[model samples]
Target chain A: MTGNIFYFLTFLTLIAAVGVVVSKNPVYSVLFMILTFFALTGHYILLNAQFVAAVNFIVYMGAIMVLFLFVIMFLNMREDTEQHKPMLSKIAAAIAGGMLFVIIIAALKDVDTNVYHPAVFDSQIGLVENLGIVLFRDYLLPFELASILLLAAMAGAVMLGKREPGERNRF
Target chain B: MELSVLLIKALIIVAVFGVTLLIATYSTYAERKVAAFIQDRVGPNRAGPMGLLQPLADAVKLFFKEEFVPANANKFLFIAGPSLAMLTACMSSAVIPFGNTLYINGEYIPVQAIEVNIGILYIFGVVALGVYGIMIGGWASNNKFSLLGAIRAASQNISYELAMGMSIIALLVLSGSLSLRVMAEQQGQDLFGISGMNWNIFYQPLGFLIFLVCAFAETNRVPFDLPECETELVGGYHTEYSSMGMGLYLFAEYVNIFVASAVMATLYFGGYNFPFMYDLGLPHNVVTILGTVVLFVKILLFIFFFMWVRWTLPRFRYDQLMNLGWKILIPLSILNVVLTAGAILLKDEFFK
Candidate 1:
């Protein structure tokens, strides 16, 4: 049952990821991206990484994607309004995409699929308590550093978004 | 994971679904009755005994009404919108524990749909997704007012969700768990010699206040109903929706209210844990049944409070809503988290 579910979710994720790229309307692309996130969350759940699954659902599918949709909706993107690219540019894009795909395939070729043996796997490792201990104990510095990076990015965004004292409403 | 266990979980899920829909159906009647009482009117007395069957009548009316799709609206999304809203609204109830464990044939079965460890986070994720239905509906309508309403909803929900999450952080710190069932179980402790009265409301009042305010905003209740404020935005996101599409959107609001009330009761008011619950020498099963009743009472009271506030309070302006969410609630909830952490530290250092 679990294996079937995993395969199904993987198929869904692939389809939705392709949909995100190929959808002409930006809103449709955003919706497809959300579906991709949902499928990835299903995969996380299948792996018994419930904490990671919930966080993925909340942060990526919930918060970030909503902002993406919000911005795309404001842009008023429609299929009829789309500008067609030149034939040369389309070929160039295809070549760029194929090269990136080949690079990913080559990088993943040596990955050891046998590393995650079901017999030796610790299902409890993905649980919240165990993950929390691992994070706070062994990976404390990296986690804190990541948080600081997020904080710096947030501060930069605020600084950039703020208007000057004498500025008028541009719109 | 036995077949019997699976069957019992399925039963509970169906039961919870039925009860949620039933309550949401009646809440419309209750809201109108409550509004009438507040405004010195009789309110729907003709449907049945004090409008008992009013909601049923309303449901029939809604079903029989003309289903409308705007001329220029995106047909697929216009249909998908309310379906998504209703879907996410119902999804959150699965994580809530309605009562204590039931002992049947010497097996312990929790009175909940599912018992995932990340229960609270699951609900949060579902609630966040609820905004998508409104956004899609409004944008699909291709109406300026509907689009504006969707924008308001998206921004309001995002802004308030931060404070709501911050407020919940304080509760999580106190309870030391993300599972709503665990939180409810933790509150089943004795406090000040009173049995089963150690509610988190006493410990995290500030957090509860912030949470209540944000809940209003997140659910798009009164004083924060700028998204669908009839005066400024017509029917808001549902302006172009009609018949069952509009009905689903409206019904979803009531379901969301019901879920929010249940969460608040479970988190702060000692869900199914009334004072003297264990002190009475009642039979175990009887106590469990009584506890479920008590939990529903608390939930209904909170629902009534939702309606009471809806009628009593005036709506906030758009800018004021933004200011309150960003400038006040966020900072206050952060303070609540700091206070909770400090208290926890002090208790560990000195009280222990």
Candidate 2:
């Protein structure tokens, strides 16, 4: 039954992912992407990665997608202006995607056949405390570095986004 | 083996949803009455004996009103937007513990919908996703006003959410638990045998204050409600919504306010814990009911406070709102976290 549920979610996720590209309206495409992310969050829950599921919901569904939707809405692009790529380029892109998928599956198959799993699926691992312990204790340096990266990103964004006193001429 | 447990759980879910809907329905009337009183107007007293039936009449009117869709609007998304808003608003209530637990025939059933370990995170996640409803609805309206409203909501959400999360982090540092149930239990430690002083409010006063201000902003309530202010963006995000679509947006705001209030009560107001609750030594079922009542009282007080502020304060200007959210509240909340951590490290001596 759980496997069937997983398959259903996977099917929906894939459909939504495809819809993200196929949708003519940018608004609809952003919504489809949000739907895909939600389905992925469900997958995280099924894997007993509750913290990951929550983070995915907060980050993907909450913050990032909000900005995407905002920009799409702010631009309010009409469907008439869509720039369709050449058919040959689309075919080539699909072929490249298929190759990448095959490569990933092949790599995973070898891991399933050979490399022993070290991470046990203990439900406790999904609790916030344990996740914090691992992130702060085990990955402290990397976490700090990631935060520093965010700080720099924020600084750059502020600098670039701020309107100059002389910039009103453009508007 | 336990059909009764499943039945009870189902009943609780339905009950919680029903109660929330009922509360949100009446909140409209409450908001109007409070506004009228504040403004020295007579208020909606015509519906039925002091406007007791005002919400019912208002709801009926909304249902009977024209359901509109703009000529150029995206059909599917226009409909999905309000429904999504209402859905996410109700979804956040699932993980909240209304009370402790009720016992029957040697079985214990928790009052909450689901006792997920990551209860707080679950709520934060759901509440964060709620912006999409406004964004989608506003954009689908295809009006410039709607677009502006959606933009304001997106920006306001980004600004206030950070401070809100920071404030919660301060509470978590002191409470030492992410699960709402455990946090409530931890706060059961009476302060010198005093009842409510044992609450987190006594310890993390600054965090509670920051959380309160952010809560106002998050709900898009007055003093921070630049998003939908009539003088500015013209109905904000719901500028083009009519009938039940507009109704859902208004209803969802009340539900969000209720959820935020319940969270505040649960976190800092000792949840369902009453002063000298343990001293009562009451029976299990009795205690559960009492706790639930206490929790409701806290929720109602916060709701009243929300309404009172909405009536009393003028909406902030856009730049002022952003400045308050980003510059003032964020830094203060961060400072709160630092102070809380320092106090925790220095032991009881810091407070003494």
Candidate 3:
């Protein structure tokens, strides 16, 4: 039953992801992408990574998707004026996507699945207690560094996105 | 062999999710009433006793309302925008531990939908992606105001997320766990036998303060609600949205607020824990039920507090919001982490 659920979720995710790339409408593409994220969250739940799945919902579905929707609504691009790109560009894009997919599949095929068994750890290890202990004691430095990276990103976003007082007059 | 257990877990999850959705629906009514009262007017008292049935009425009204597609709007994206907002908002509650485990028929069943080890990080990661929904919706609307609103929303979320992550790191340093249950367990134990001193808020007061502020900004509540600031961005991102589309965007915001409040209570307020919980040593069923109730009450109180602040404070300017997030909160949170580490190290060596 679990395997069936996992396979179903994986299939749904791939389908939606492909829809995202192929859809004519940009908004449809984004909506499909959001569906793709939701399906991926289901996969995480199957792996027993409940926290990661919830976060997947929270971060991707909550913050990022909201932003995407907001942008799509704001632009209000009329379909009548939206001309399809040349066939050459479309073919090039399709070929590139196909090549990437093939490369990934080929790489996965070489893996020796028979030689591998899932590593055994205490079931409690995935509980808040064990993860906390590992995060604080062993991975403390990296944990702290992640916050710093976020800070840097915030700074970059502000500097790049915000309009300067002098520059506003030109508009 | 264990199909029953899984079934029970699924049932509980559905129940909690259903209840939360109901609460979110009413929260909109409550917000309108509260906003009215704050502005010195009678709130919705017409729809059922004192507006008790207002939410249901509103839902019906929205359902029957004519769906308007702008003449120039991208039809496909226009439809997708609000749906994404609603979907992402409701998804974050899945991993939260609502209560303790109840032992039934020789088996221990946890009350949470699921217990994932990296719960905190997972929440942060998912919330980061939520910005995309607004961005896509606004950009798709083909309205400049919507675009501006979307940009503001994106900028605000990205800015505040940094400080929020930092504040959480400080808490992680002190608590030494990412799992909500373990964090709750730690809070239940008294350090040095101090009565009623079991919460993380007492130990990491500064971290809690920063986190609370960041939560407000993250949810796009008032004071930090620049994304939807009416005077400037002309209804922000959802200006062109009508009928159920607009309803979805509005509903999603409240749901996000609910999720944020729940996370705050879980992280710093001992989740479902209460003082002298060990003294009762109650039956497993009672314990689980009581924990669930306590968690709900705490979340409600946080929601009330959110509304209270909305009426009390004026919205922050865009630049002011960014400066406060980056300049003040981020630095202070970093200082908190360093200080907490030193304090913990000292306590281990000298106090022992």
Report the number of the highest-lDDT candidate.
1
DockQ, 0 to 1 scale, candidate 1: 0.91
Better of 1 and 3 by lDDT: 1
lDDT of 3 by residue, B1-352 (tens): 3889888988988987997798798888888888888899889999999998999998899889999988877687678778877887887787788887788879988788877667777677657766766776787687888888888888888878888888888788887777877787677776566522489888889999999999998788998999899999989999988889999988988988889988988888988777766667678689678877988999989988899899989998888988999899999999998998999999999998
lDDT (Cα, tens digit) per residue for candidate 1, span B222-313: 98999999999999999998789999999999999999999999999999888998899998788888989999999999999999999999
Docking class of 2: high
lDDT of 2 by residue, B1-352 (tens): 3898889999999999999988888889899988899999989999899999999998899999999899998788889889999999999999889988889767889998888888998998988988888888888888888878878987898889999999999998898887999998777777897653479898888889989998898888888887797887889989989899999999999999999999999999999888888778789799889989999999999999999998877778888888888899889999999998888888876655
Clashes of each: 0, 0, 74
What TM-score does prediction 2 earn? 0.94
Candidate 2 off by > 4 Å: A86-102, A113-121, A163-171, B195-197, B348-352
Best by TM-score: 1
Ranking by TM-score: 1, 2, 3
- Per DockQ, the best of the predicted structures is 1
For DockQ, candidate 2 versus 3, the one ahead is: 2
Cα lDDT of model 3 by residue, A47-163, tens digit: 666655666776777667766665664555456778889999989999998999999999999898785345853445554456667989999999989989999998999899888
For each candidate, what is the lDDT? 0.93, 0.88, 0.82
Model 1: CA > 4 A from native:
B1-7
lDDT of 2 by residue, A1-171 (tens): 899999999999999999999988887888899999999999999978888999999988899999888777777588788788999999999999999999999988856554435575366777677889999999999999999999999999999999987778565
Sort by DockQ, top down from the best: 1, 2, 3
